[model samples]
Target: MQELEKKEFERLLPYLYKRKERCPTFVFAVLERFIPGFVFADDLNSPKTIFVGTDSGLYFVGGPISNVAFNKHFLKFCSSKLKEGRRFTLFSGSGGWDGLISDCFRLELKQSSRYSFTFHPEEYGVKEVQLQEPFTVSRLDEATIRSSHEFNLEYYERFWGSAGHFLDKGFGYSVIDGETALAGECTSIFRGKVYAEIDIYVDAEYRGMGVAKKAAQAFIDHCLKNEMIPCWDCNVENLASRKLADRLGFREPSSYSIFVKNQ
Candidate 1:
């Protein structure tokens, strides 16, 4: 795929019809602030379809790209990128690339609903549980971030990359067990105004202990205090996550699909 230069990127914005999501938008925000080598690309003619790829995944943005020729180019470009081993997942709103990619690759096309829930602390009622012994839930700051990096570099790298950036732009809460970070609830993606999407990471050993819920509560409280609304999203089949959202007073789950690339 041909990369779009700054001017080309800006000029193409008005013509693009991207899906409304905070995560990918957060990538764009990070690109603007850090210039972290993020790439944006699209077809040459009409340029109806486009995407932005980061370390985490590929985000398909813009258009009713029904053109056959463009789809083929898009496929070739993505396959090449996949071989390069940077982006691991494909997230699209409308381009029908899921089907196109499946037709060419052996990857499994798993279907799941994307759930978006709203936050209302008052509705949480008595379900809120404070962290007790063996667990300390607190706002994740620079110090904790460093400790986490030192604790487990390989596993925490996903959550640790650009930690400072996210901490500055939004907020995060971590469940610490003495020295180890057991679980965390952080603002994964945000639009810098009224919305921030929540992403949680709980160590396998700490699952089902209400650690995620506690950390999430801390994050939700921060958002409410700051006049920002917190959003929780996940695959519908993720029952535990759905339950956690329910516990945090999030209502009205929604659905969407993201294509995960298999190795």
Candidate 2:
């Protein structure tokens, strides 16, 4: 497999579009150069398979499932990267791809299901959330993010590379109680071309207080105003996340598999 440069990244778009399901936003983040990642294909000129790796995870698209040489090369590449201490989780959209990866990896791998949801603005309507005194909803600015001792700050840096980049390319909201951020919802993966996948966190002490819902509503409002499609993804077993997405009018749950190192 050959690593394709950023300019060559677009060549894989046709393959991505061929998939029936929505492509993961992280894949677009890499292709758009919004974040650092690598793209590889079986052939530069006439590719049969494509692979994308990012700090978040790995994705595979395109095929000739029987390409033994490319499969071996892919396995060797993954082994080397894993040995180098990179925690790469393989995301598979179809059972065929899941089976392919399972057969190739000799190491113990754990499997999990992730659910993807699409937002329906009509269903959500224009409801407003009112917070009591001492609690407020605020846009996620650099200052607020920097001052936050919660997950929001680390999320931007880890996923978007830095707060500056996140500010320029993405947006979010947080619910604060007094001087502390109680909950936050932000763009976990965004590609201006289409969707913005949300990521949310609520302080343990503040769970079930509607703080997370408030933050998420504000985030969704921004996405609607900007004409960007809002998307939600979570582990299938995360009932809280699934319920929140449903409450937010995100419908059509689709299941996909992700393989991670057994730990």
Per-residue alpha-carbon lDDT of candidate 1 for residues 1-263, written as tens digits (9 for 90 to 100): 45666555554443442435333444443334332335444554445556665554545543455766556666776677778756556665543654555567655434334766767767866466766676777776667667663333332334335555556665677888876655554544443355566777777777777777777777788878788777777887889888888877898775556666664
lDDT of each: 0.60, 0.76
Q: Using Cα atoms with residue i matched to residue i, what is each candidate's TM-score against the true structure?
A: 0.70, 0.88
List model 2 lDDT by residue over 59-102, tens digit each: 54446557777777777877776676656687775777788777
| Residue pair clashes in candidate 1 | 114-255, 114-256
Poorly placed runs, candidate 1 (over 4 Å): 1-4, 7-48, 67-70, 106-114, 118-127, 133-135, 149-167, 177-194, 203-209
Model 2 residue 196 CA deviation (Å) reads 0.8
lDDT of 1 at 241: 86
Error of 1 at 122 (Å): 7.0
Candidate 2 residue spans exceeding 4 A from truth: 43-48, 55-64, 179-181, 189-192
